[model samples]
Target: MRRRISMLAGVAALGLTLAACGGGGETPAEDSNAQDASGNVGVFTWWADGSEKAGLDALVKVFGTDYPDVTFDNLAVAGGAGSQAKSVLAAQLKAGNPPDSFQAHAGAELQDYIDADQLEDLSSFYTDNDLTAQFPADLVDRLTVDGKIYSVPSNIHRANVVWANVEVLKKAGIDPEKPAEDLEGWFADMDKIKATGTIPLAVAGSWTQVQLFENILLASLGAEGYNGLWDGSTDWKGAEVTDAIKAYEKALSYTNTDRDSLSDWAPATQLVQDGAAAYNVMGDWAEAKFAQDGDKPGVDYVYFPTPGTEGVFDFLADSFTLPKGAPNPAGAKAWLTTIGSAEGQAAFNKVKGSIPANTTAKTDDFSEYQKSAIADFGQDTIVSSLAHGAAVPVAWLNDLSTAVSKFGGDKDIDTLQSSLGDIGEKFAK
Candidate 1:
């Protein structure tokens, strides 16, 4: 039987309080000396492959230039979208062995760490560095909890994007420039590609399915309804959600049959890159992967927001936080400062296939796709990404992911709807 939503809330609150209180371990002293001490700094993340790793290496290169005395420890664990890293992080935090700093999604996702008091309040760091002026106001708001900032954002990624192979589209006799306007239209294009002996869509297992589902929900419900999913203004059990699920089911039907065997997003992206598949719905980071493989944007592939989400930026950010018990608090602060710096973010995002979170960062080095994302991020209705831990708590997202995985095998809309409604009631509050 499923746990009651209220029960989960109580447990979460207790966990947060215990986590915040140091969990019976020696936490770093809150003094200028501790904040300035330099030694080895361990930075944890799940950026162990492809363009993501390249991005991390670029940032590390910049850090090495600035802090030559400090040894940079790359504690990257292999996982798609930090799935494996998160589990390790949770265990470490519980054992009172937090890294010097670690990557996290901005927004409600960081709330857990904030609640646990496992994170140092970076409010002073932001004020000292003038980050309040550098980053966008909306993005800063997302990174804040109860008026206290916890993390410094490195880059912004758009989740609702469909990357297509231009050559594959040409082979299927479909116009690459004119993408479909809705689900039905997208299905028509997929049918044409399928007829040409090419896989119409490519998707990886589990987490990517959640990524695709969130975009489908955005396309089906539009910005207002999608925002309501997090804020309690929308009905999860309503007909609109059901319609979104139906659309997701149809979309999944067009995906690669061996999707379960594809362990990470990079392989599925490679399917589109190699032209075994025509399209892949993934975050803009896939752009970085293609670029790393020596593929040019317009000539090799094209990207657009998923159907019906053209004007909205489905947003998430890669951010780093200073853990409470970090062995090198000063070094962690220095690392985070570098992450928020203009030069550092530019170097990182240029390789990572994302836009710098700092609005003041120069974009001349950014690709056409990244430039467009930056412009849209500034002008569009911004919404948090569910799959990437921006819109919900870790536990809530885990529950949702479990339901999605079960639904993939069961194909039971009724069960999916029930599980979704229960999650909404529990987490959306």
Candidate 2:
């Protein structure tokens, strides 16, 4: 489970062997060489550490077995949630020096790449690989643009989970088994935890703040209202939105005061694992981290959908796309094939704390939390996750993140609401 994938690029000498075996020794066109097909496939992602990196390593293993000739050049840039990698990737794509394939969110966030003509049409890749019938139809639809699929989703993650340390909750005289039924109930429990001198909630800076705000929005506005936020229907200044903002403000009060100093979501989750905090609202990936640290799911830590979000799935997918003009087009396609395959997905999600996007993947090896996630994904009302870059364009998400960061410092609800209104108007147009 803690295996590290070797990121070494196979020696360039192997490309010569491949070329020599193909026919008479007439050198092939640079773009038509086998190296371009199955040589070093530059696999790009932000999975620089933790279970996320382990999962990528797992997938890389699968790719190596499937195509022994191809070398995996792991181009991972370390930053929480692709914050640093995305900027690097954008520059690469803009300069036409694209990686063979790169990780991306599977919804509207991909529209920018599609708009910029940086991605290859992957519709035929789906059909050729028989993936059209293997992946969820709705997921396929979300990944499609202009009647063509562009990315292959590796796994699905739920964004509305709250991870709590059972011991911390018990110390606070709160029942760990019975999580709050609503936002008000959550506040009441937070009060009790506060009295016990534990950090009532643990939150990290930047994107994690947006993740919390979005879940709070889901809890306050319900699934329908939450969906309306991405579309043109939800009024950002409405009373429901106001209520959500108020709830977010109150919830912020219970968070660790040192939250601003925490750079990543894992540290916030660590607070819960170390029993310094009662709750950490985050994606299910935290479960994988806990498991890696030898914590049992129900005993050491427990999870529930963030309060008031019981029947909803704030969902996002980690996907990979074939960038146009890739150096190793063949290797890229092979990598995508493995990503969309049942065996590959099963291997990846088992370590990554997500459910396979491929429905045929067996869940027998998944953890208890992952099993519950599979069930929830099957029945819950699905909505795009704003924090994970599924619900809006990249620019809009950046703007929203900036607004949330400012709100964190200023606590100005009116200004925050106005900014959201402007973002909505700009994106809607």
Candidate 3:
């Protein structure tokens, strides 16, 4: 996904003044005429290229059918982890001139906007549109705060996938169609891949890499130890978490790749695409990269959950949120509605490599990997990805990332566990 969301104001003081005044007020206000008024939807996002962009573009295109006059102004900001875009968005909202719509995660992450009263009460709109009928209860529950719907999800994404280069696996004397079921088997396969002169694992220190680390942690520790770290119900200093940390350190030893020097998600993905690396830990959306490279899933590449992890499902969802005070309230709402509509969700996820948030949407557009993802959703053991920064509180997530990175960089398991214990205490407070 491209990081293309940025602030659209302040290029010129006079220009901003005129734009605000043009709204027929001294300061910009919501388009009350929306629904009853012609509303423009100003969307802020980070999807600047590739299949991710295609998904959002499809949503915008369909939105035009129902709202022609509602001009869709997209502010594309480019920054990994959306850090730069988020900083700009914070400034705009703080200055009382937020975008009509912006993207937000479908978990506790939205609490920041809700705390600032910078989000609208979407309860009525959700009811009016009957969105509950299509969205899963868990998804709707995640986006709801108190009693109001603060956002509308476009799709669900699964973290914790092991993407392999089928050709590379064959060269390594491993079956591309069948993956190892446990950590020992996984390591053995990696050794075979390494013996073949291919990078056994394509990894980096980037946020996405950290996400992959967390997925592995969950697989190594199981859901009990995994959820305990963030839910305030389990101890991070336990044998399970320690074992997970040790496994991560051992895995990092195998990350000897040209990608070790880079910090982007695409390089690791490209390694798999180019068949330079035997495996990569990424989300199912990686299927898009494989498809883009003309590689066929199950033939050129295959997906499996991190080896040996039970309850082998990780859940996360993405959505667009309308800022509380928007210049294009109507357009934003229309876009949100379009996002939830079965057609829009299907169209977006088909290209983006994610499952539609609307459960009613067809999965035909998804590739073989995504088909398995949808099947996984049916299992009762699915859990959220704390490493991808979902489900857990932001503070705990950052802390966990720091601790995990240290562990990956050769920190002792004992020290890593101690750090986790300290972070867990802070989260509890």
* lDDT of candidate 1 over 1-429, digit per residue (tens): 111010001001111111221112233535533235466777777888878999999999998887777678777777777876677677677777777778877766777767778877888888888999998665666566677777888888889999999999999998899999988899999999999989999999989999999999999999889988887899999999999999999998999999988878999999999999999999988999999999988888999889889888888877888777777777787788789999899999999999998877889978888889877876787788888887888888999999999988888998999999999999886
For model 3, give the 10-residue run with minimal summed lDDT: 6-15
Please state every model's RMSD to the true fold in angstroms.
5.9, 7.1, 6.0
lDDT of 3 by residue, 1-429 (tens): 111111111010000211231121223323333354254556777665665666678778887776776667766565434534655566677777876667755665566667778777777777877898887776666566677777787777877778888889998889987788888789889988888788888886656657766776777867766666566677778777777777777777677545446655667877877888888888766777677668777777887778876445776666777666676565666777788889888777887788886878977757776776777766736666664445655556667777776666566888888987898888753
Cα lDDT, model 2, residue 386: 88
Clashes of each: 3, 0, 11
Off-target runs (Cα >4 Å) in candidate 2 are 1-36
lDDT of 2: 0.80
Full-model lDDT for every candidate: 0.81, 0.80, 0.68
Give the Å error, residue 112, model 1: 1.3
